[model samples]
Target: MTARVPDAPPHRRQGFGAFVRARAANGALVVQPRMGFSDPGHMRAGLTATRAARAHTVGTVTLDSYTRVGDLDAVEPALRAGTPLNGYPIVTHPGATTRAVLDGVAGPDFPVQVRHGSSLPQHIFRRLIDLGLDATEGGPVSYCLPYGRTPLASSIAAWQECTELFSHARDLGAEPHLETFGGCMLGQLCPPSQLVAISVLEALFFRAHGCRSISVSYAQQTHPGQDTAAVFALRRLCAALLPDVDWHVVVYAYMGAYPVTEAGAYRVLREAAELAVRTGSERLIVKTVAESRRIPTVEENVAALEYAARAATDNTTTARDPGTDSQTYAEAQALVEAVLNLHSDLSRALVMAFERGYLDIPYCVHPDNRGLTRSRLDEEGRLCWAETGALPLGRLVHTGRRREVTAAGLLADLSYLRRKMDREAIGAPPGTELTGSA
Candidate 1:
């Protein structure tokens, strides 16, 4: 909501990447790049040209079929000495059927990450299948609508869309997990009241349907230059939004001039890490800092991450100290409220899920399109499906057990389940029995 003010304290204009390096106080240094200058060939050529050139030239590059043409495998070993690659393979393709094949090609440099999207919903699943083919493939992916409390009808519809997609994929013999986040992808972020409602749906609806991973794009929702307190407060709110799920916070630094100063953009990340710690979050995905500039060459990207790692230093925190002051709290609170109101408008999508008896778990396992999600509802039906015993997203055939996202809820639902095990614990017991609540 505000511009980044690195020099000013938290009370100031709250909120704040690429390619050149500079020195810091203790003989330390940093690097930032010129904007609009990320072409793969230009970058590669620049690498070849810079050593001999008499003058500087802003490199020019283009998307090689939308893929970066740099040889990251070759570049990484030399550049990343102390820093570790996320190791989560980001496979970029256009379909679902590739899942198996991709899964088949798994290796060391690329552990497993399925990055699929950029197509209409119909072909999305098929692309996923393809990804699955490779041994190195990760969760089959698709972009889903935003799951925030933005209250925008369009904002929340994707949940159902994904529920349906999951149903269709299941029938086709493709089982995949969705990538979820609090905001982005038409999803909404909201006040606690609204978040409560949304979380209920997140837990129950996702459970009833069949979703696995629920991600939180927390960085996208944060404002830069804001003091650490304010940043921490916003993170706390996000924590409140998804308390019951095994979620992750994606730390996206200022890849651009959206609202952060270079120093402030530098600062927002530490703020984010602090908040994540407060939330007791286990997983953290730090997006590349050089993204806003030209396409980072393998070395440059690695360098950018190295800088971020140092920038996000002193990351020792706990659940109690989310660490936000008053002004920061107010700013974060207001943002959540606006997003929550928008979520109300989007409730139609949530309600529709109830009416239809199922909702899509917008899990975008792919890192493509900056990690978006997609939902489906069989081969027909625009928004809603009119069939009996069928959910809005599509027909649901119990996966023999239950949905993934709701595993947490299932444990809660099984409050009585534990007691049954206890009561029948004579070394032999039944899977479903109740002695009380566990």
Candidate 2:
């Protein structure tokens, strides 16, 4: 049976969605950092520093791996032993502890979103509910496949329940905002069409489960032109399908590999900011120079945020409109329609779509994934489907020259940006072809 979405009240202006919309309306791009600390004092300090950065910004409480996988026992032991965790242990931390972390830092001007890679996020959601944090990002397939081995069916069921639980945050006077992580599956090499389709489909799932405020995400891919077209396609799809919801697009900086050189890192981030501004994306998730080496310091995060904000301002008046008739848009539309037509229930439809290989992510090895699809970076550096598998785009997209992506080819593609940017740092011309380089 198709579960009807209950009527949601008018959106509150103080919520995360409204805050972002209001900022964007005033000609500001909201930049955020994926930062979290196990210590409440340190987390609070990070949030405070983020708020103090010279940029229009938001804060994030990204959770640690243990809490994300629901291994609370491991988290307790680590915390008790003072072993530093990679991110915040939201589930293991006390409610008062987190409250202290956000007591005065998180407010209208500085809304915070909890970012955790979890398919079963019930424990995490319960804590967020208690803390009245209404903003978070994850999706059934996006969180399930890339992060762990959780069965797709189990993840879908868990996400549905958690999304429904999030929807009720309105009763606590906080409007719930959920961002789909679908566009960033496997972080790189997946064709933009599939990314756009999955993002839109996940947003639809969020809406059908009663979330009224949503944001669709897209990561910066190999080619700027392709990323531009993909973001435009994502926005067009959302505008058509999610007419009644409060929605926006968020651009994540190059997610696969980071450049070793600080200059290269900044160049990539500046490109991402330019992409966000040019494509009319309302938010950008900033990555710092330390990404390729270690967890970025709070100072590095602030520097990246400030720099991206500056780049956005510089390009604010020169936004481009890619229009809706491109190949990316058409392919994404076909994929979304194919999935929706599979079943009346969005969750069931998604499951069946994967089961039948109608929606496949290239290079993803999740057991639920059909593994027939493959993608490669073309000579122009745009991601293309090397093999279409059973994605409904067989006739729609022509794989001009099919080449098997060998192990060496895959490694090269994975490090494409790192090499290109590092070369540029050493006075190589911009946009140099990176065909064969060590």
Candidate 3:
């Protein structure tokens, strides 16, 4: 039997979705950092700094690993031992402690979203409910396949319950907004069509489970033109399918293979900001220049936010591409339609799509994933599928001379963006390929 969620009174408080929508309406692109710290004081400071930056911004309370995996016991001991966690441990930290972190920083103007890579997020949702937080980002497939060995079935069931739990936040006068991490599956190498399909599917799942406000995500891929088309396709599909829901598109900075040099890192971020502006994406999740080395300090995150904002401002006049007839749009629409036809329920359709190989992620090793699909970076730096496996691309699938992705080829593809950006930063000749030397 399908679980029914009771409707709550309309939330008067403008939450994350409304905050992003307002910024978009004013032609301001909202930039956010992936910043979190174990200490509540540091976390609060980070949020405060983010809010104070020149960029139109949002706050993030990314959760630590132990808490993400549901091992709450390990968080306190590590906190007491002075060992720094990769992110804030929201579950272990008392509700009052988290409230202190967002006390003055997060509110109507500055909304914060919890980003935790968890397959099972019931406890996380419970914690967010208790803390009066209304926005969070993750998808059953995105969180499970990339991060761990959790079965897809288990993740789907858990997420259904979690979405219902999160929807209850509307009762507290805060609109519950959930962002789909599906477009970022495996971070990189997956084709944009699959990314778009999964992101839309996840947003539909959230809606079916009682969420009214949602965001679809797309990470910056290898090629700017391709990434722009992908985002446009995402926005178009969301508009057609989610007619009554309050939804937006959020683009993440290139999520794979950070550049080793600071110059290269900043250059990549600048391009990401330009992409957001060019594509008319409502919000962007920015990565710091310290991404390749260590966890970024609050200061570094602030600088990144400022830099991205400046880039967006400079590129505000760039013309938007109408991707209605683009190959990306056609392929993505095909994928989304194929899945929707499988079952009336979005969750079951997603599971069956993977099971039938109608939807496949390239280079993902998850057991539930059909590993037959393969992708390689083309000479033009655009991601192309070497093999489509069983994806329902129809005439869109590539039929060229396919080359196996050797270990050397894979390494080169991973470093393709970093090397290109670094050379550009140093004024190297355009189209000069790196020879693997510093």
lDDT, residue 413, model 1: 31
- Flag clash pairs in model 3: none
Tell me the tens digit of each residue's lDDT in model 2 across 129-174.
9888989999999999988789999999999999999997786565
Predicted structure 3: lDDT: 0.87
Error of 3 at 46 (Å): 0.5
The window of 10 residues in a row where model 2 has the poorest summed lDDT is 1-10
lDDT of 1 by residue, 1-438 (tens): 111111222331210000110111122212122211122223344333322222211121111212222233533443245332222112232234223323323222122223322222223334333434211011111122331222223323444554455534433222233333222222211112222223333433443454433433333222223323333453465455544433333333322222112333334344444544444332233333333343445454444334444543445544444344444354345434433443354344444443332332233222211221122222221111122122221222222332333445323432322232234343335454332222
Residue 140 Cα positional deviation in candidate 3, in Å, after optimal superposition: 1.2
Writing each residue's lDDT as its tens digit, candidate 3 over 1-438 gives 001223324647788888888888899999999988999899999999999999999999899999899999898899999999999999888888888888878899899999999999888999899888899999988999988889999999999999988886676567899999999988889889889989999999999998898989999989998898888888888888887788888889998888766777888999899988887788999998778778999999999999999999998855465657878888889999999999998889989999999988877789999998988988788888899889888888765887978999988888788778877776777666543323
